[model samples]
Target: MRYTDEELEVMLSNYRQLRSQLKDIRESIMVPHVIQDTNVGGSSSGFISNPTEMTAIRLAEDDVLNEIKNIGLAIENTYALLPKHKQKMMMAYFIDREPNIKELEVARRLFIDRTTLWRWKHQIISMYQIELEKLDSV
Candidate 1:
């Protein structure tokens, strides 16, 4: 949803609050190893292999967790730039991307009637190109 300047302020505030909470959750957390590897991959029949598979897996897991945080930030920033009514729908749609979220689910989250949600989704998409252009110019 593209929000107006006023809406952007509110969304930015929301974003900051959410991020603060995330920070606390992140700090108290530690990556626990459920499994350990004893053999360091080597010749092992001279086949293709990674010795530090566990380490690689651990790093990949961290990467995915980081990606989640990054996506949240991106969504919030993008939301700030959208028009007011469109922001919720756009954010909802993004949230629902892949495996598709039910329309009702999106509507409930935004607390808007379904009809209004659909209308705004379309309206915002129609304005999407222009908004992208504006962002690009900036």
Candidate 2:
């Protein structure tokens, strides 16, 4: 289905958010938990049983992973349809998270003036709208 610009923006935001969450997800998955030990008379047995908590965690992780994959694919497909310059603009301005670089810095890195960067951003959005329309028609 074709998405609107707002929808696309939201998707992109979600993709970024999900990517940020991956570290926490990995940590959760890697956390080690000990199974409860059972003792009978003078014998102690170490038995590992699949706990519901772990199962729930795994299921949640899978859901998040699947969503991340789906969103990443959608973003990639749309991004690939853009021209190289537009792609670079999108990556620098939206995708790449360089905490130290502001928007003007990104423009400078791309060798374009701030005004040109703004203009290109609008043009890229228009191009993206056209691309999304085409996808919807297909």
Candidate 3:
């Protein structure tokens, strides 16, 4: 839903890590689960409602995967919604910050001074919040 600037920034900063985690989870899910044979004796005790802890672990992993996917989708969708020039800014600042692009480099690439770059970054964070709001509505 709606996110604060700090939250949005954190999501963007961790975007790459999220993608890697999503990939890892998908790969793990592809692995076959070990099947264990359990023998039941007629001792009327409903002590455990759930039979298999593996099922619970699988459900939790699915939940985590879904959460990471949602965050990644929102970030990508927001990035896609921006104009080409703004997308460049976002890419340099967030998605492609591996080597950490300098302010001068970004300014030169976007043909703007440092002040405008900083302002545009703030604007982009606001845009991300708005985009997340729209997603929540849907």
lDDT of 3: 0.76
> Which order, best to worst by lDDT?
3, 2, 1
Q: Candidate 1 versus the native: TM-score? A: 0.35
Cα error of candidate 3 at position 66, Å: 1.2
TM-score of each: 0.35, 0.47, 0.67
User: Across residues 4-121, which tens digit of lDDT does each residue of candidate 1 receive?
Assistant: 6444334333544556655654543433433443456764543225635644555556643554364355545566777776765675554433336677777888898889877776
Question: Where does model 2 exceed 4 Å of error?
Answer: 1-16, 19-70, 126-138
Global fold similarity of model 2 (TM-score)? 0.47
Candidate 1 colliding pairs:
1-86, 1-87, 2-82, 2-83, 3-82, 3-83, 3-84
Q: lDDT by residue for model 3 over 96-129, one digit each (tens)?
A: 7756668778778778888988888898888777
Worst 10-residue lDDT window for candidate 2 reads 32-41
Clashing pairs in 3: none
Candidate 1 residue-wise lDDT at 16: 42
lDDT accuracy of residue 90 in candidate 1: 74
Better of 2 and 3 by TM-score: 3
Give candidate 2's total backbone clashes. 0
